[model samples]
Target: MLRPMGREDMRAGDSDRKTVADQLKTALDEGRLDLSEYDDRLQRTYAAKTYADLDGLLTDLPGTVPVQRAQVQPHTPAAAPAPQTASPARQIAQWAGPYGAVIVVCVLIWAITSASAGHLTYFWPVWMLIPLVFGVCGQWFGKGGPHRR
Candidate 1:
């Protein structure tokens, strides 16, 4: 009985050659292969007759798909990622850092501008602090507040 043709043994077509040529061009662009090696690989890729032949050309190049490698493998469901829930204190702390940074940066900008022109600039950054205060109040006094049993 004649054995069935395996994937590697299958004859490559023009499209297959074109795909390999594109991959080789990418390898050249990434500096993985110098101009001489790229030219050699490009020539060999066009001259390739089978998938196995094409596979050898890109075996050492990074990020190029192996021509003979199986496209699909046995599927196994991956474990789901764990959900994240932070405690009130942790949530408050997380909220504080970013807001504090914004406040500090704004205050610095205000001071610098004030000094630059010869007097204190208006403290406009106080407006930015309103959201931070409300966020903290919600975390402490809202339905999910820490004090609720």
Candidate 2:
């Protein structure tokens, strides 16, 4: 049996239930609760038919998320055309465009040596031109490159 104080607490709990029922009814009347939600809540509150049942009616609803996920995924942007880049161009452009003096030197070495000896091997430095083109194109098409946040 509950103590006298426990009896008082039980009465208070009953009063709280009445308050909740009244609030739910008011929400239904005021059109705050949709017809479906109001009907569902009413079913719970009334069909419970006992203290334990009523207590179980409002289960795990407050402050609960709809779904659970171990980790949030980083938003990857949609795929683009084959040539589009995900990074800005100014960076590599600096090395390929403004700092392309090294390419010029290599070319000169290959040019001066090609006529005298075959060791100039201009093809070695030719590979640098690929990245250079990419950097320049990046500067052109990279206008809105890479997503912001």
Task: State the lDDT of candidate 1 residue by residue for 1-149, as single tens digits.
Answer: 99998988999999999988998899888889899999998999999998888888878987765744548678999998897866777878887888899899999999999999898778899999999999988987875577774
TM-score of each candidate structure, all chains considered together? 0.45, 0.30
Whole-model lDDT for model 2 versus the true structure? 0.60
Return the TM-score for candidate 2, rounded to 2 decimals. Answer: 0.30
Q: List the global CA lDDT of all models.
A: 0.86, 0.60
Candidate 1: worst 10 consecutive residues by lDDT? 64-73
Cα RMSD of predicted structure 1: 6.6
